[model samples]
Target: MLLKELSALASPLNDQQIGQLQKTVADLSPQQLAWISGYFWGLSQTPAAAGATPQPLAAAVATAAKPAGKLTIIYASQTGNAKGVAKSLEAAAQADGIEVSLYSADDYKPRDLAKETHLVIVASTNGEGEPPDNAISLHEFLQSKKAPKLDKLQYAVLGLGDSSYEFFCQTGKDFDTFLSKLGAKAITPRIDCDVDYEGDAERWRSDVLGKVKETIGGGASEVVVPLHAATSVGTASAYSKQNPYTAELVANQKITGRDSGKDVRHIEIDLGESGLTYQPGDALGVYYTNSPALADEILAKAGLTGDETVEVAGESLTLRQALIEKFEITASNPQQVAAFAELSGSKKLQKLAEDKDKLRQYANNTQVADVLGEKKTKLTAEQLVGLLRKLTPRLYSIASSQEEVGEEVHLTVGLVEFKNGDNTRVGGASGFLAQRAEESGEVKVFIEHNDNFKLPADDDAPVIMVGPGTGIAPFRAFLQERDARGAEGKNWLFFGDRTFTQDFLYQVEWQKYLKDGVLTEIDLAFSRDQAEKVYVQDKLLAKGQAVWQWLQDGAYLYICGDATRMAKDVHEALITVIEQHGGKSREDAENYLNELRKAKRYQKDVY
Candidate 1:
């Protein structure tokens, strides 16, 4: 009987909680089980009952009544992509006369899942097969023994992931499985999308909307829900990802030392009274053209004339212009290779295409011209346009605060460089911003707002910022904004780079701020300065006590930089510091960190 009871409850408890519960309740009686359940239920119900003191009965009734024919959209986003998709879907759904409610996975309580009728999950998988940070708790709850049955719920999932990963869209798969196990009906099968997810996501949305209409017994006629419309208020005046504003480049200066291997630029673009507004943590999206010389090489190698008219997506333009402003030329995809090899019918190209590994390697190094040069082929302008993907904007972290710089936008760009068979190649956006764009020349740009990364509202709150390399961009803005506001906050910064002499970015400004008493503390870590490798993590451990004291004193911690190594190492270092300084165990320290995250004390702007 006890085993059966345990098994019944196992489905509702998380992996960790279930293990603990099982150990504690192994010898408990059925009466004890009932009593524990009652106790928890009472605890959960207390808040609602407490409201009876002053609330009217009508208020209680209104709360109990659910909105009719409403769509609940939940987004599990790791890097804001899924959140963008979810916002788009909500706009579409609202336009169709369906009421919509949006929630981040972390913000929504698991107990409320049972109240949902129409559910849509927009989820993105993290590195490997991990669920996004926001989705972890809800994901655990859905697979736990305490999960409520959802037999009446109609659901659909849209999973965003990169095909390059081994476990592509694993989080979506998990959600689908858990929903099915809980007896929820699938309104539509889950769709897993790769990097170019816009088309796939649109198709899935249409399918889901159709299912939602049928399930709710609504007619084929489109329903408009005015309340669900996307907000047009406070939109930036400049160009954005969808419709970019062309802003003139006012200045571009090389900031790095000449002897340094890296080339970093301090770029300034004139918003030109566009009334474009951007905060400190926002990123500027730059849409750039491929190098003209490279385009000429491609056209010549392909045996095609640049003047040929090509019709793409109902627009006719010269092949050269299309290649220059519209199509992607730097990166190559597998689909393009397969399509081109089949079109050319070259024996050598066909042989290379036979091996996926070889094809990928060739595609990575060689451009369209190099590939086409290997075989002589006559291609129509339309075919050429079809073979190429659309040009996407690159996001560079904004290095200046609007509060400090006004209309001008500043960026600390590290130009990309690599040797290709004795020839130096640079990334399109970085090179264009650094070398091609002239002073006072127009460059289309926009702002991408990041709400997840923000400064604390309290002026006096202490802040710890750890940023190395290009990751120091936003922190620059933070310090500027704080200084401009005359904030009383004590700011501590841990900045690392190659060498202090050559690579210490914004050195003069930092020194000025230190002298002005705006910056309370500064920790410098130059990895290549010493014989053995030394990073920010090393400095963090050295000052663990002070760091812990700052945290204890209600300091907000911020991390910006390399997502792969730096972020991971810094996180481990934080855990170690917390454990050592707070005299807590490893697990307790992790929970403490998690609490900081939940409280919005720990923030990361990592890429």
Candidate 2:
């Protein structure tokens, strides 16, 4: 009877899952089977399986018989970064003879918190410091009055975010606060990491693992399974953010018109049989060197020889190479300014560092060279090297389909430029691709897989894309993919720019798509053309009834581009559409949007 039930329970299991289960319980004796049964029963006691209740004694017996050491890691990922960190943490924890179970926050029940002994929470903050979609319910539950006391729980959190945002690492901070409020004990202090998070994440993992080992001691045990045995995927990729593949640029063409305000390029690269496979919504990470002009300017300002040798992290290289390829020269941080002020004893640097707002202003306006140029102090090579942060890769949305163009990756990039007083400032990555990188030049690239932002598997499902400015990139890929698959889905695009004549991107292709019947509708919002500035949100409002009808017809809505303002306004507009067209109350409309999010009908690739 037990074996039959086990088989029934495992009916939906995949091949890998079935194999793993068979391997794990292959040598189990009758006693071990009884213990395993109880262990699974305990896990099934939560609200996730509320219909079936586990026997108390059975659960206790199972707990006593099974391995005492285990780690529960929950990740609330907005853009897959937190998921990556959680995966790494689970791997590290399991390597040390600790049983580990990893889960996305959306899949994990809040009630399970009471039973967890060792927990690690990895989360990323979204727009306006709100929790990621996956973490919304869990975050609310922890803050609710009904939250259970978690006095027995010991946990740690790792936060991933960008420093450019005001609420840097806000989600992680919220998690820490919630856990502490519920009486959970801290295993270690939470580590808030910036965009370049690997080094800090590794250190945090080491600390957490150390604490776990200290709490539960054992080098080896009979019940302990090898870490690799429990891995969901096979061997990990060798290339990552730190180490990327240097692929050659095969094609570079201006997708936009000659008179366009935005210089959008359609770039293609040869993967060269690297066996890299990426879905439509994934981003391509490009590693680029700083411009030679910028590097020369920095060297001249600092009064340092480009040929001077500098030792960085045990490797010695020319100062120019270090600045160009290794260190961050353009962007300034508070830490960098503080360090420089202390080193140089400059009153201006020290004064700038005192006020947070003023410091940020200074960092934004001044480059590393500009800061050094203002001061007359001389610095050693080591000091200069220490002042700089490691150069990081930039991620651009992929705009091509493997089905359409196999073994090749395509991107749509908008060159970033701004005037800094008398001098013109350009974005490091965009400028490199636009001006520096030559045709057939080598570009270090890698694919970042995004599981959350994929088109529906069913080709018949309709899609509505809301993208303005450079945000139209992935939508182009979506249309191409749908066209390649010969999908029956209707594609509707709502695009906006300053002017249709000067800023329209992929105009010819869009026309071609319209003629070919690949694109069902195209709505353009040329803001400056009219007396009143119009945007995509305004267009959405204008076509509220039709948009609502499309939603009713099961169309997937995807929004891309600016997260700060546009995404928020579009969201509000969507709510208004639902309210007016669907005849629903404001709260009901809000819930409707939430339901769409839960069902993955409303997806966003906003950044």
Candidate 3:
């Protein structure tokens, strides 16, 4: 409030002017302050009228000046993490006084690539090195015969993915390769980051901005885009991966029958005025406190006393506390295995570490506790923390639309529990939410928005959704949202599982939707119902004609489920249908599907 009230400082403002300034800020929220700041900045760019009164420093401070040259940022994200990162980079670039234009990968025209002066891509690898739904069009276009030479362009890329997957950061690699082949110059080398991406992302941003600053000297600005907002209640959200809100767990129930082989949970959390906004395809990220029981086992295996001191995230804590609150100990990876193998010199670990494939298999099959326990590696608290990745939250596809449930979000969480050695291993977040956390207990959560996966903008457009197993989460949100809006679009759903009797997720809701005529047609597939396994793809082939007809009728096709097999098989089935019904070769049929994707008529929420 120092200089905010004009009278508080030595200023030339008259009483009336002071009163006006106070009134202007009286009801303004943080975002309003930010916008007004930009607004005045735009005004400052225009030369002031001659002989006009000198304005307050605040007005001058709000200048929207930018650095020299234009920078284009395009992001391809399935669960919105890359978009969030891209937006963060845009804000940072704006702060450095650079003009930035942000676009979803699909929104940017391929023809424009040859013309871009400066471009940066923040892409996340989807399943098995595949480009995300939004990235597919651009990915294909660059490799297509129509792509132009981009010798005139300068670019950078930042890829985000989980290192546990074999093709970690493969999308970014592909993008870099394609751009190089097209003759584009690298502004800064591409950086591939694992799930613990924020730190690496920050470093990449600083280095890239430094390069931009060197290439394009700061000067007067022109274009302006939405900068990332500081976390506050007034904006869309302040709660995110960095600072999640603590929401209470109101319900945690088993959605599937007790007889089912898989243990999937229906989870609900009370937002409690957190103002967290999410749509149908968004994900709920839950930060869990590692199971104390497991944490103790890890500490004991390292031969460290529970009370031994350790530092994590800049705070000092006991060894036990740090293990539970700071590091990832459940899943093993190549890096972790290599670190342990080298530290302990275990002949068995040494042999496994010699080969990449064998190391990966060992990591996948083992746990952190088991690795340390196997070799009795005596380690200090610091050494142990140094060996592990920072604890990261797990994201579950949101099942409830805000349109249907205000101030509350639902998640379909499939518990990840399996056997390893003599003990049972459970996923960090999944174990916490589904097994450990009691009803009404608090849980930390945030929304990861997905713009690529959305309902048809046209209410009358037909939609075909194929989601089997826990993949049905987002479709539930879709139907709920459609029902709430009284949409008249025909809805067709093809859902499958091992058995209808025990594995059909949300069966009651789909039946209710059918009864209400909201669902135009429904096809069910229960793999174990008969002698032959009948999955969703089987059903799709059975009704291939109708599916192809829907495509011809301007239907939007959506697929969510297992990316490793279900998505691929369903894709093959759809191609076969197009070939048979539309009378085309395999290549033409594939082209047809690609066009559908390019037109945004086909979308997948596969993991």
In the range 473-581, model 1's lDDT, one tens digit per residue, is 9899999999999999999999999988789889999999999999999999998898987899999999999999999999999888876679989999999999999
Among the numbered candidates, top TM-score falls to: 3
Cα lDDT for residue 546, candidate 3: 96
Please give the RMSD to the true structure for each candidate, in Å: 14.5, 9.0, 7.1
Mind giving the per-residue lDDT tens digits that candidate 2 earns over 31-149? 44544565556667767665665344434444444655467999988767788778877766645556678999999989989988888999999876877878888888999987899
Counting only residues 3 or more apart in sequence or on different chains, how many pairs clash (N, Cα, C under 3 Å) in candidate 3?
4
**Residue pairs whose backbone atoms clash in candidate 2:** none
Q: Model 2 reaches what TM-score against the true structure?
A: 0.83
Deviation in Å, model 2, residue 189 alpha carbon: 0.3
lDDT by residue (1-607, candidate 3, tens digit) is: 5446567677867776676566556664443455456556566577773456866644533332222357899999877778878887877666655667899898899898877888999999987798987889899889989999999888999999877677889999999999999999999999999878767887788788778867754432433333233222123766767779999899989988888889999988899888789878777888888888999899888888889888775799998888888888888788888888899989888898888888887887788888897688789877888889988888888899888889899989899888876698898888899977774388999877777788888999999999998999999999999999999999999999888889989989999999999999999999999998898998999998999999999999999887778999999999999999999999999989988887878888876
Ranking by TM-score: 3, 2, 1
lDDT, model 2: 0.81
Candidate 3 weakest lDDT stretch, 10 residues? 225-234
* lDDT score of residue 458 within candidate 3: 93
**Residue-pair clashes per candidate, as listed?**
15, 0, 4
